[model samples]
Target: MTTRAGLITSVTLLLFVALVAASALAQTNDSVAAACDAKVKAPDYSLPEWPEKAEVKVFIVAADFNPEQIAAILTPLRNWSAVAEATGSQVTFVYSGPTAEHQDCLNCLTIMRGKVHDNQKHAAELQATVNQGEQTILYARLVIDRVIPNLTALTNAVAHELGHNFGLRDCFECRAGTTVMGLIRSSDGLTGPTRCDVAQVRRVYDHVRIYSAEVKRRKPQQVAKIVPVDEGEEPVDDDTPIVVKKP
Candidate 1:
């Protein structure tokens, strides 16, 4: 008994409701993806020892970043070092802000200030040159934008960028709350690395074993003590007198 116009209106309203429902469902899926607890696979390789004998060095460009921001960045790095402490691996991170002359040097991490891919949306980035077979990080650059001016944002940016140095890769799946390496979500506090991140870093740096130069070189002593031995080739006692056998 409904008129044609009424039927058309009813159909349009139903379509509108369906579209709204679809949009809502998509948002829900996106949120669930972001919150998915997943960890990135750890690197199977290791970085070579630094020529200068440093385990790790983090240098930030002397920009207008404040003390809080710097401290926030250092927190995760120190946590990362703690994982290597079991092997007596000394991981050192210095703020060498602008004073680091060897930013391009091997095994060094340089934090720079610039636009993130010329995109205003991104706050920071991490780039590196890793070697093959050895998987050594010859050099790394951490680009961040101080213009954001948010301390928490900057700190989180630093953590995310440094995560790359520890072998954290971009999320291949819905690996959000599992670690800082995952896709950042509203649920993320952006404070520090999660257990998954620390475990991965440990796996990477645990290969470093501390050894002394003398032990590594296996060099013989310059001087040798003279000892008298038997003519038959048997070793003589310390008190045994040397028997001079002259032909």
Candidate 2:
């Protein structure tokens, strides 16, 4: 009992609504990207980053962290890898097991626990040695305080520190508890990198390099292994590599 013209009009209205929603979403993303760009602060007017398609090996000190603590510490690295995969940025952080095995890794990052000096109030710190001429990172170390309030705090702390390793500086202008690079830890249940954080990473590695063609031909590598730890079960110490790639 419906006219052909009436059915066509209904379909047109539905399509219009869908288009409007898409436009609004795009605008929101643009606004967030702009905010992220403003927060980037480079040292000496230069941004230090790793090479294109580089696989920076990561090793955690087993004596300093237990299974549960290790899981919490690794959450941020996995989050960054996931973001990189989604954005098609060829860089990734691969977990290479204990520090003893990969001591001679060229581009390596080690995370260990250390004392929190009374003079230094920070919960964690990152020390990166960058090659000034090439603007590439050679090696880095992340030292986390021995005593932290909770796992959430530890996760956020690691996320903030890792941001430094990825060529991001602290954003003093960012609103409190909004970005991982901000002065204050986010209070709003965010345990990983934000869209703003990843945007800056993409911006840092946006240059075309001589090895682009070679990188494009390479396959994705295993980033990390995250096994579920059940209640009342012994913590499994499996160092099996797991892959976190874009679908």
Candidate 3:
């Protein structure tokens, strides 16, 4: 009932539509990749990362948070653990219950509800103390504002703060509702770390692993030496520092 030329034309139109759709999908993927790269702000200095396969104990400094609030606060930690496993990162965070201990303890991440004021003065903030010489995070203190409006905001705040503990900085230019590390909280119910955030985490830990291996290879003799130097002591000959690069 149809001419050969007409059938050929119909097939050609279908192929054209398919090609356009594929091209659009490819462009979208490329855009997402570019955005991910832009959102990751790598420092020029050596990255401070958790030791390989380190289990960072999470301590809630204050016991005032209710069950729901506590659950919201902890959700991000568990989500980050899953992200780490999926991305081949060696770090994991385990909640160790409420703590009366000081915030300076090693391998501990303390979270407490308090007044946090920064330039943006968002719902939460984290201060990570890093041992720069060893390129490792000693401990971190996360302070959350006590007056979050809802559980969704609380979860997002915790997730964003935890990103800092993993050595990520805020991406002010990133679109809101896209990634947890963005300056603006997501509005579309995103409360966990996105693929971009996890990818950066993997990149950081990978850098640490590669650097450690290179150090051992270059200075095999000094790898086992743990001598403590005086504050003002002169540097030793084999104590040459390795400059860490952002991967």
Candidate 4:
């Protein structure tokens, strides 16, 4: 009992709905692609610092970083650590000097701040690999320099470098309010990681699983333990030895 015109109208409505659904799906895929351009792959090489151990050891390799500068570096780290913990991916940092002990530490983040190399114009550089054959990173080292020496710039640089260390890529053009993973300095003037930044941390680390056999083979010794502290506590004193705080 249906007319030909009625059949055509019904077909048109169905096509419209299908088109809307396809468009929505495409947008979702694009959003995922934009956020994680370089997703964290399965680790061919594992480190003791990552996964369930939940600790990241930091060694200050450069003599240039005074206590104030060190504290500035720690601020964003502390914030990010808290963000990771909120998502059930626990992480804390143990600050250390460039002693022989640090040389033997397997998965520490060795930080050096000084003049950038001739070929490097960026404010910072992060290197972590073994002979470039193995794609997995066992350790991450950060070298920071003054491409634009301002407080906000340097702080944001540290935050951005830390994001790379945490296995995130530059999602500069992603539709977010602000992020530390921008390719260039953001005019938003944010000196720390934003909500978008923390969300990335959660995405990467929250469901991380440790491979037991890999940990057994690498067996890195714990450099220090973390002590719980209030989030609003003052920065550590200049002359005091570096300490690890619970996230």
Better of 2 and 4 by TM-score: 2
Name the lDDT value of residue 113 in candidate 3.
71
User: What TM-score would every model get versus the actual structure?
Assistant: 0.53, 0.62, 0.65, 0.56
**What tens digits encode model 4's per-residue C-alpha lDDT throughout 42-70?**
21122212444457778875565667777
Error of 3 at 230 (Å): 30
| TM-score (C-alpha, index-matched) for candidate 4 | 0.56
Q: Tell me the tens digit of each residue's lDDT in model 1 across 48-108.
A: 3322235666676655446676776677666655555432234555555554333766567
Best by TM-score: 3
Q: 54 in model 2: Cα distance from truth in Å?
A: 1.3
lDDT per residue for candidate 3 within 150-232, as digits (tens), equals: 77777777787676666665665555555676543434355678877766665555455545655545522322222111011
Pairs that clash in candidate 2: none
Q: Kindly list the per-residue Cα lDDT of model 2 for residues 114-173, writing each as its tens digit.
A: 664431234565655553333455666676776555677677777777766566666645
Error of 2 at 237 (Å): 32
Which segments of candidate 2 are over 4 A away from where they belong? 1-47, 86-88, 100-104, 116-120, 184-186, 207-247
Give me the overall lDDT of model 2.
0.58
lDDT of candidate 1 at residue 104, scale 0 to 100: 64
Model 2 worst lDDT run, 10 consecutive residues: 228-237
